[model samples]
Target: MPSLTHMALVELEKAGILKFVISQNVNGLHLRSIYQGRLAELHGHSFMETCPSCGIEYFCDFEVETIGLKETSRRCSDEKCGARLRDTVFDWEDALPPKEMDPAEKHCKQADIVLCLGTRFQA
Candidate 1:
């Protein structure tokens, strides 16, 4: 279940107070909260799997079985594309996916105020 904070973010987005959300969280709570606004999951989402061939993303009800972009048991829904789906979560050695990174960078640059929540900064 999504936390109260996640719910609040959704409300804020609905009111247009929150333009975009850049999250490092892989738990997919933001998505589960039904936030239909622009979101960039920089570290990938636990419940999301993507097709390599068709570039289609599937958001699952359950947490994906694997991380590090490994293939999952499911295949793409498109009749023409039956490629295996891969988990979106990143391993330690994995590079940041450009699909999420590019928009995150753009949003950061364009924003006047950036509110970061629940993040730990190490010195």
Candidate 2:
């Protein structure tokens, strides 16, 4: 269900025009579009969960039932560390995660052109 804009981004990445993507979208559409290059999901992806202990991420096929970094019904898959898995999405008051933000900042500093779509700058 990738949109034409998403497909175009993928092609741009393939053609080496687009380097990295910094997305505020929680729907996980960029990954679905097959853009396998660098990405930083600032708000968090609804289909993703992460282990608080091991920092391993699990990308689910369906939307997670919880947000606000709440614990899901599953545990981490790593045999040595089966910590509780928490949804990646954030609530209104939650601060943006540094794991996603740091790389995004780094990319933004390095990029010559930053193309933003469907979002507004809040100052």
lDDT at 15 for candidate 1? 88
**Distance from true location, Cα of 118 in model 1, Å:** 1.0
> Candidate 1, after superposition: displacement of residue 82 in Å?
1.8
TM-score, model 1 to reference: 0.88
Q: Give the deviation of candidate 2 from the true structure as CA RMSD.
A: 1.7
- Candidates in order have lDDT scores of 0.88, 0.89
Alpha-carbon shift of residue 16 in model 2 (angstroms): 1.0
Q: Clashes in candidate 2: how many? A: 0
Output the worst ten-in-a-row residue range by lDDT, candidate 1: 28-37
Q: Which stretches of candidate 2 lie over 4 Å from their true place?
A: 34-37
